[model samples]
Target: MRKPVLTIFYQFNPWHSTIGGVQTVVSNFIKYAPDEFEVRLVGTSNDPAQPNGKWQEAELAGRKLQFMPLFTLQNDNFRSLVPTTLKYTAALIGHCFASDFMHFHRLEPSLATLHWSGDKTLFIHNDIQKQMQSQENANAILWRRFPQAYFQLESLLVKQFNQILSCNSESVKLYQQKYPTIADRVAFIKNTVDSQTFCPLSLEEQQEKRVALTQKLELPANTQFILFAGRLHPQKDPLLLVRAISALTDLNVHLLIAGDGELATDVRLEVERLGLSKRITMLGSVIQAELTKLHQATNVFVLSSAYEGLPLVVLEALACGTPVVTTNCGEISKLLPANCGVICEERTPVAVADALRQVLLHAENYPIEACVRATEPYSASTVVGAVYSDMWHRWKQQNLVSTVQKCSTNFT
Candidate 1:
């Protein structure tokens, strides 16, 4: 029997990039999706050289998957909404006809194509209103002027989709309260990590890897490493981490930032301004393997994001047996087991610095085993993948029943 076609629409291209959380989630879903379903992705590309309107075949977990880049947005900071919507809507209308089920990662891309009918799912990764509010405060006067318009769009999306997938309990609760009529449609599917690859290292192994990484980056030995691995965006607040590091005058610590983004230059300037250029290293956009090693080598992973869905890096760090010091953003505080790490009360530099210092002082009490054990329920193959499988089966059965009822009514 031919398999059902599942097409996903998102903002980032999943070809060979490892920049954003959405891309990581989409890539993992494609990797772990049941073999009985055929998967395809429609997204935007940052590479100006990538040709538009082309289907590229790639293999994941021994299965073939197709990707179509509808448009190229050279500058990542540019949000040319009208042009992006027009080009993507035309591309989706032309190519998405054969899909039995559609999955959308963001609301903006799905706005123009809402007229297309199918069994559709919308995965809400972050609170759209909160994010828009933050954007308006930082930049984008348009968001401030027409905030209600954005809320209306979000409400329309919530009402239109057949199913809503939320990454955390907080989002699920928020949606349930806002759209009580469709509360049953919202489900939680936590983010996952590859447990095998990100597993804890032995003492000797950690020391060896630490030495190699330090030497590779030209840092001294016997120094404590604290890692922050995400885009240097306003939402992530990478400069906060730098400020916290600068305040720790008495500790022999080094901060390693392992990603780049819109605020890269600003982050660098902040590091220099704080006179932490030597104490901090900015490793811009390392591959997955390097990230895993960095997690294993570090004493603590820090997440200073103003908000999030459920960060995959936090799970990955826990899987590697590294503790965390993070703000109470998203469901991270709830997800963290006691003694696995520290959850700050606020996102200020003083709070983060205090949390990091405490974690560093008693780091040995938070065992590697404890960190790894906390992540057992979030393993990619066993837990996360099974949830997706169950969702697909349930939705398919519901659709079948609805179709049968329609036919019966027509015959009557």
Candidate 2:
């Protein structure tokens, strides 16, 4: 028997980029998927070195995966509209028609899959409608002002999918509320982390890492570290974290921010303005190994995002045996075990500061063992790949039955 082909559509090249959460999710899925399934990815790339419209084979999770670039749209703006979208849609339709089943990583690319008559699933990684309302970009502003138009478009695209994989229960609720008719189609599948790579270190190992990191980063000995790792965009509310740190003047804590984005300059200015330059260190975008080390050495991980689709960083932190202080976003509140961390009711600076203060005060109560255990379900080996495999089988079976029904009707 031949293995089923699962083709995924997303804009960014996952093999090349590790910048966004979507990229991370795609990488993980492709890396951890079962060997019985043949995974293929279709996307656009800006890299001038990579030839467009060619299928390239790459190794991920010790498995061979294929990548086909639909077009070479170097500019981000053009990649979504006009001739670019048309060309992409044409290429994607052809690929979808050839594949056994299709998977989409974002709303925009999923739109192209609608043209193909095949079993398809859309993975909701973010609340698009919510994001538009909060973002200040010109396109987001337009969508916010004309939400009805946006909703109509969204509803049309969503209704086309045979199945919708929501990253969290919150997303499933949001989608069901928006499209009640498709309520049965929406299912919650939480994001995952590499537990082995992010597992907690022993006491001696932790001490050695802390001492080494302190010496290398030139930080004060015995100072507590609070880490925030993600893009410094408005949605992430990186400044709110900085303000929260400023409010904790009494505590001997240092805020370590990893990753850079549009608001990088503003974040730096905020740190300078609040006189937190000495208290906060901005380590612009570290690699995965370094990030794991940072999580291991940190006293607590902090995420002050206004919204999310279940951040992988939170899971990564927990897997590293570090507690968290985060806002109530996505399914984070549900995933966090009791005594594992603090969840802020509000996204304001004051609320975040209070939560951080509380967590810092009783940090020992959130044991490393508890944090590690809480993340058992989200490990790549345990849940993510298995859930994906089951979904694929279910959707494929449904598609086969529908095809047989259509044949019978034609014969009659």
Q: Using Cα atoms with residue i matched to residue i, what is each candidate's TM-score against the true structure?
A: 0.90, 0.88
- Which candidate number maximizes TM-score? 1
The sequence of per-residue lDDT tens digits that candidate 2 reaches over residues 168-265 is: 67678888888899899898887888886799999788888878877876877977889999877666789889988888977888899998766789
RMSD of each: 3.0, 3.7
Q: Give the best candidate by lDDT.
A: 1
User: What is the RMSD, in Å, between candidate 1 and the native fold over all Cα?
Assistant: 3.0
lDDT for each residue of candidate 1 in 60-144, tens digit (9 for 90 to 100): 6565888777877664433445544456656666454446788887666676657777777888777554566664235532444
